[model samples]
Target: MPNTRWTIVTGASSGIGAEIARQFSAIGHNLVLVARRREKMEALAAELTAADRGFVEIVELDLAEPDAPAKLHAQVTQMGLGVHTLVNNAGFGLRGEFVDLGLEEQVTMIELNVTALTRLSRLFLPDLIKRGQGGILNVSSLAAFQAGPHMAVYHATKAYVLSLSEALHEEAKPFGVTVTALCPGATESEFGARAGMEGSRLFSRARMDAARVAKIGVEAYRAGHAVSTPGTRNKLVKALGRVLPRSVMRKAAGEMVG
Candidate 1:
């Protein structure tokens, strides 16, 4: 009964994660949607199933919990779902002076953004390697390119994601397992409000649609690309971040999110 072709997408209840699920389903891939929001995931499952895109299995769980990765893997095993693709997209951001943010919240952010992602990857990567035709798409951010002063922890976490993904891309390549890092700039999603960044200058400019970004990411993964930063503007911005002075970059980032 193992659904050996299932794609496991974390944070699949909303935003980029939800869009990614939609795209994957459209391509005939059955999905295991993981998120804390059961109702939302159930709704999405109904829609996807109604469209006859693919089968959808909603798994409501908080990835931020320390044991979530193990629990998730066990659940998948129980369901006989072979995870052919793992999308580590369950993460969040916080905007404010590092010192002003609640220590507990920031730590939880790290737990989800970095710890949970690593745990899940470690848990699922072996199977993907054995399959030799699967992929891992990690959702990093444009912030990964440089230091983000006001959103230091969030930026750092994304940087970790980008670094890990790129390195894994090379290591997994010989096994025919593709790893890709998706870096998106400002996006129109609940992320801005949740992160307290809605009024920031970063969102003052036009933001990319989550659906478009998701499509680009999924396509890049399928193409075996190591990294994909959607949007021409975002690509240019990341390119500039590469050569810009550290001080200048830091100041600009601070101002944009401060």
Candidate 2:
């Protein structure tokens, strides 16, 4: 490393994480791709390398594990790379009634989606604040706008992410650090299959492309937007919880999960 500022993107093996990495790299930002899948990262790194846009480093990690955020921060510090941005995108979702799901798995979802994201943001934010630039692009979801049925835990985690990111943005913006909460609707990714939502009505139709979602997120972060809802009608996400009756929104969310 030749004294470079880097962007750390977690869960960077596939889908939005991978696409976001590409987006940043295209704009000439070196990246540290963190995830459990080394081979996947290697392939992505190869692709980015061939583009000759920016350097790509891979850190294989399970962010759900305790101490992962600390370890990753330490490793990045040891390598002498100053982090410019931290993309807290390492997360997953499961679709099912909360009570019917395995307890440990649900907890793990919380660990990765909420705890890990918070830890990484805490560890890396001071650096951005000190530099008076850079940003944190958190991959929240449109589901954060309302309570989701069948995917209760996942929705709750995303809600937490959205709320936390917005607060951080308000605090960091004065210092010139942007914290963007990207609230994209259903996108073409492994998330649907992994969460068992692929067969659901919400995903039965054509979904937004992962590349498009990533592009929108990167644009939002660069523009210092606090929250972004990609591929939505009017994109007035704040209106969802207010315009619709709480009961009606809840029922509609449940019906979509069918």
Candidate 3:
């Protein structure tokens, strides 16, 4: 049994999730790095262990599976590991009109983004309550604030995450559980490529850096903030979404993402 406080970071094989795991490692937190790519996670564990003298457990998982959370809970329980933090960062995007994208892709997105996140949070909340202190960081997106035409389903999933995280923040306050929604803008990663936007100049022009995004997410969660938008531009976009009419916001988002 691992007796130390454990921070579980999903999608930790690469990109933002990897950076988040790295940040947690720097602070001496033992990790359970979850991803579908076992080799990548093992490599990350090796690097973090060597560099920071930190401990990391690699779990090759596909969060899109409905039974993943339950399996994860059982594994952690069997190991007698105490989870102090959970970062729900395993999600992807599909870039196309709703009618143009295949139904399976959208379903997979929902499975990973909404169902997996909700289940993990619910599964871990009780333990955190018993311990009287813990944190949950949900990785949403700046698109969560508005309706995106090209990324409708993905944006909608993130909106659910943001709303759910905000509500959880309030509900968990008395229980000493902090919930934070990390709303990052277009990040410099292979996400755009995977989403079929590899040639997008707009994506390339965006200012988000994965490391900075991870830092902001961890800092916000530690500070007990309910929401964290990494970049100033993203912050402004959030504010605008709040102030603008829903129709106008939707149109603007469509233009930007389309």
Candidate 4:
């Protein structure tokens, strides 16, 4: 068993998740990358190991399962791996009218984006608190600032994440632990394709590189920021949303995805 303290990054096979993993590895952290694709994670593990980023562990499991968090906790404990950070980035978005989308798919999004994240945070957070360091970085979205009509549940999940991370940040401050919500606007990622959002007006504009998004997120997490929204454009959008009428933001958000 590796005695090194590890950073566990979920949804780490590619895109922003993979970029975040690379950033952590470059900074001298061993990693435990969790995702559904074993082959992709293995390839990534090889890359990180060859680069001398310390040991890499790949756990191929669907975290959407209700029991997966317990299994992950047991596995980490069995390996005697001290966790330094948790990155909850494994989630997908669906775009469509609520009534038109498949109910099961929407529910699955909730399971992955909301339930799994909450469970994993609950499972590993106490250890970080007890140790008086490290933190959890949750992947939120600019949509979190306002309602997204076509992607209603997705926006709601991110809003929950941002809220949860901010509250947790306050609770962990005395313990010297941070809880940061990394909110990025549309970036180049497989998630965009999977969510069928790549061609939307929001994504059609110049998108931030996945690497840059991760870099900013890592910096914010290190700085112990409770909320970090990457990109000047995204920051402006969020600021505007704060003052805009909800009905107007709703219309704009809904139109962006159309």
Candidate 5:
């Protein structure tokens, strides 16, 4: 039987997003997986189906495109899938000085990380409020809590996500909807290589597993927590940012990225 409600996970082809989909499916939530790679999503769908996890739907899309959000919503509606959860996980980061990075790439990053996330949240929020019980899980980063010198735009985007999610959490309380920001530190994933941060000190240090991080994030969403940082070390790092001076934090961040 088809699940009555669906959890939509963007960037579902790999990394944390992929793990989140698996965990959600394991918990018997029907899924709508969206990503730019159709073949990858199709493979995931097949695996989930073979396991009889739940009904899995794949929507291959590049959400960075201006019309993608509306088109995605339309596809879900057309498929008669009522969205019970939205995971805005489709974003990437670039490790470079802001001025040295390609202008087009930075703009596209903003489009994906900030614009797409905000648009999807707004597009789905009305329905979630009407249902009065759904949730939004935004995958931010530990970078959200501090300023990053080399990856300035990426850090800013995550900060936006953290801020937006917290405010939405408060606003949605009366409606019984939960909004959570999952802030994970450097994890074992493709992110480092893709972002050109593979050789950075941060990635060289200890990292958490994507599956573990995803499990923690999913559990936090289920518990209606406003923000969740997976590893104990990550939590401590985030806490330390509170007492550290802005100059010190910036210097530390710059050194890590270097």
Candidate 6:
């Protein structure tokens, strides 16, 4: 009675999202790739299927769009695909003073990062619970541990992810559903460029490979780890953030990311 097939990967068009999709496909899991760019997803679907014989379904939908979660649920149901895994990775960071970054962008980040993630996890929970086995991997960041100065809203959204994932992990334990928060440190991705952080001196030193990060996250999710911070440095930083006074860690983190 194993409910096998179709893992939904949000933000699968690029970066960590794309890498996670690729890893799942490599392991012979059927995939449903969701993102705003249809062409990119189609291309990825082609590449993954061509490289191997894995099944890939491309759905181009903006997670930030209202009613997105409902539509996504309907589409999956109509396709007769039962989701056994969910990867909430579709989120972005806006760099700049919170007041100057424009209220719209800040709101959109919350909609996608916190709102969509919550809705999707809730929508899929019943199905997973009935089946008695499933997994959810939420892609958070090292920024979740402390308040960010310039990237205030983005950091706050990730903190929500981390907190929610941990709580859900414990709640879902008896139901046989595992929830994990994959907190990655600075990685080589187009995230900087998208967030207007291109060519910044802060990113010159953060050089983790995207593939490696994806691998670690997938393995951790499979192993049922409640939280997995990939790199040692990131793990240490999170530990310090947990133990240090909020004021002290906040200032240090702001300076580091600033």
Query: TM-score for all predictions?
Result: 0.98, 0.96, 0.96, 0.98, 0.98, 0.96
5 or 6: which has the higher TM-score? 5
For residues 195-230, could you state the per-residue lDDT of candidate 2 as single tens digits?
Answer: 999889889966889999999999989998999888
Pull out the clashing pairs in model 6.
none
lDDT rank, highest first? 5, 4, 1, 2, 3, 6
Q: Local distance difference test, per candidate?
A: 0.93, 0.91, 0.89, 0.93, 0.94, 0.89
When summed lDDT is taken over every stretch of 10 residues in candidate 1, the lowest stretch is 1-10
| TM-score for candidate 4, residues paired by index | 0.98
Model 2, poorest ten-residue lDDT window?
232-241
lDDT of 1 by residue, 1-258 (tens): 523478999999899999999999888889999999999999999999999776889888989999999999999988887788999999999999899999999999999999999999999998889989898999999999889998999999999999999999999999999999999999988899999998999998899999999999999999999999999998998878889898888888899999
- The reply for model 4, stretches above 4 Å from the true place, is 1-3
TM-score of 3: 0.96
| Candidate 3 lDDT, 1-258, residue by residue in tens | 434879999999999999999988888789999999999998999998889546788888898999999898889889888899999999999889999899998999999999999999999988898898987999999988888888899989999999999999999999888999999998987688888766554585766889999998999899999999998888888899888899998888777657
Clashing pairs in 3: none
Tens digit of per-residue lDDT, candidate 4, span 14-60: 99999999999999889999999999999999999998779999999
- lDDT per residue for candidate 5 within 1-258, as digits (tens), equals 556878999999999999999999999899999999999999999999999887999898999999999999988988877899999999999999999999999999999999999999999999999999888999999999999999999999999999999999999979999999999999998899989999999999999999999999999999999999999989998888999898998899989997
Best by lDDT: 5
Worst 10 residues of 6 by lDDT: 198-207
Off by over 4 Å in 5: none
